[model samples]
Target: MHTPASMVTGIVFAPLGLVLVFTAAITPQWREGQARLGASGPGSPLRSGAKGQGKGGARPASAGALLLLRSDGLWESCLQVENSELKQCWPVAGSYRRDPRVRLAQGFILTSLFLCGTGIMLACIGVRCWTDTPLRGVAATGGLLVVIAGLLSLTALSVYTHNLPRLGMADPSKAIKSARFPRLSLHPAGSLYFGWLGSCLQMLGGSALLFSFKRPAYPDCPSCLKLRVCPACRPCPEIPNRPDNDVYEVSC
Candidate 1:
């Protein structure tokens, strides 16, 4: 099998993309939120009366300064206090798991990652240079799988982006109003950007592998000549003797 340069390059890219996507999937930075606290409330430890009060009993300036929330994924959430350098994380709530958009995004992203892994394995098998013949069909199928994976990831990212605002905001429709945090705004994080980039790479690598499916052209034979023969029974032509060379030429 003839392995084209494009296929080799695609093989490299497919695995790299898979790694990035996998990393993004595991790392909790898909979405980020920052809220400025105005004086800590019931659940917060940064209350004014707690620790280190001045002689005049004035509130510390950094008491309600910065609160950071980061999500590694739909499953986990993290909180960080900027001023005190305190950090905490916990599993996502059942309400978040019940949300349709969040569930869809998680499903799609996970499926895409699975497909990418399968496609990369298939591509590796198909593009083996040691084989007598290249597995064009297998490689093409792998490329198709990779393309589908990219599409799935893109869909998940799009859905997440579209619902980001609503996801961040406190929902009045839910019964658990007190459970939701107030005055917090969310934004896309580095991991979300990495996921987007990984999807693009998967698509590009798949396309390149697809392009490698072209069949090699056969070279024309100089020895064979095209001849117009009668529709009736055709007879072989007599050989012509060559004086200079011992070779004889025959026509059909």
Candidate 2:
């Protein structure tokens, strides 16, 4: 049976975190985006620049538009739903893309947020079904899951709790049980302890993925502090001579 949306968030976090959402291996959304980036790789003008670039002075950062080819010809896509008249992020500018380490941190955060969002969506769905299912044992179970979902979300809000590496995960999946109707968990529950457990698992998986990827930090200014210190002059380096005009400019 397809899993209920209520269980989706927990399940999402439990196995892989939301980075899986971007892996294309698990989620088509990410796969499409990856393929798009890959196909356009060399021709991308922004390829020579950062994932995003700052504009002329305060031009604000831009991530650039993606050119996607389909039977319909070429089009620009955004992370926001395509063709949505309401989305402002179309063209997707100024968003941050991370190197492995930072991206790893970000993956966990995004996954956590996704889980919470899904949990809320499912809770709303459950509420809509509440009137029809109150006498059903699963209805009570659903309500409990909703409450638990909210509480688990709050637990994650404590910040950086989701950094656990999956190597450390402890299994409660075996103990979690469902009384009836839409039983979940591998089992189901009224308490949400299992939901929280899934959240923790996601954190670990995200951390592991990040640790596996090497991260590179680009230098913003090669002339900055540490670089400015010449090894030959470490004790006391001679300052470079400057023209009179340079002194005047400095005085100015």
Candidate 3:
């Protein structure tokens, strides 16, 4: 049995892509930023209401304050103070989880994972190297599914990235006042880079697999060199003799 080159490429790329995507989904570094904690630093008695603080305390200066590193992911968020053991993490909740873009991203990523898994299974079954010929249609179908899954993941990443800062900003009233909220600038993090790369690999693998839809070319016959014939149309080694008494008529 001969395996198509595309099948091999797909087999190699699809699994790597799946691994990366899964890793990104489980990690909590989609977006990250550092917050200069002033009076809101840990153990501060004035942590609750910075709004009531006098002008002196309301300053957003970072002197003698801890820098809190915050990170957000599809499932959870984490915060840790630089050069300190203080760390906190929790599942996404409140307005963050309820945000339309966040919910869509979650759904899209889940669906993409499921579909990609199913497609990989189908591809494995279809790429039956033990058989004389591969199941081209089945392999192509799996490829299509994988391509769609990649597209879904790409969409989810795009939505999340484009609205990273606005994800949990549905309620403006809940936002910390500028005076108290330290200088926090968010940016795409490691997990997002992983996801983008994974999605690209998925698309490339699926596209390669899609080539399986075309029939494999047949090798030229040894008896008649340079002449090619499809397997189904090739002449058999032996032809049964027709009865001499029977007359046959042929029409073009």
Candidate 4:
């Protein structure tokens, strides 16, 4: 059986989208910020003797005006000193985890992943190329699920983006609150871009699959199935000449 072009497109792009979204979800770079610390200031974030702070459990800080980088994701957070190998990572907790927006993003993204995975399985089963006629309806149903998953992912991304700066605001350890260097800012990071791209690809793939719902036109031939005849190559039968004057035959 010849596979429809749309089905092939959906098969290719949907998996790629799924991979990208999964990568984004597992990564800890959803949002990142850098704060410059002063070694000499009493309120310095990285002061040698200062207590540990933030959702990521703290380790020792380098004694300098070095930049402190923080990254946050759905499940984990990481912190590192600029240009240094000293890094600490931990699962997301505290007020940040409890935040409504964070919880919403987490739920939406997780659900999206689950739905997309299930949809892909359905699509694979429906794309039975060995059969004479493919299950276009089943394939289309999968496509709809994939499309919904993409939308959910997109919603998660949007919520996280619009509330990026406010996500970890409850953390008292933020350098922005420090008087020494108060200009620290947080912004969307690499993972968000990956998610956005994946969402787009998912939508495109699902739409392509949806097109398969339309039936293809074929020439009328009773033996065409067994002969595996191409519609274009199959010739129509000619009408037989009749001897009866009253008898009439007409081709529509």
Choose the strongest candidate by TM-score. Answer: 3
- Alpha-carbon local distance difference test for all models: 0.69, 0.30, 0.78, 0.79
Candidate 3 residues lying further than 4 Å off, grouped into runs, are 39-63, 178-183, 222-252
Ranking by TM-score: 3, 4, 1, 2
Decoy 3 TM-score against native: 0.79
Error of 3 at 22 (Å): 1.0
Model 4 residue 199 CA deviation in Å: 0.6
Candidate 2: 10-residue stretch with minimal lDDT: 68-77
Q: Model 1: runs farther than 4 Å from truth?
A: 40-45, 48-66, 70-72, 168-170, 173-181, 221-252
Tell me the TM-score of each prediction against the true structure: 0.75, 0.20, 0.79, 0.78
lDDT of 2 by residue, 1-252 (tens): 222333444333434422322232122121122113221255554354323233222211234433322110001223322221222223211212322322443444345455434533443443343332212233223333333433434343322123222211233364334321112111111122333444455444333222212222323223332333222122222333434322111100
- Tell me the RMSD of model 1 versus the true structure: 9.1
Q: Alpha-carbon error at 205 in model 1, in Å? A: 0.9
In model 4, pairs of residues that clash are none
**TM-score for candidate 4:** 0.78
Best prediction by lDDT: 4
Model 2 residue 9 CA deviation in Å: 18
**Candidate rank order under lDDT:** 4, 3, 1, 2
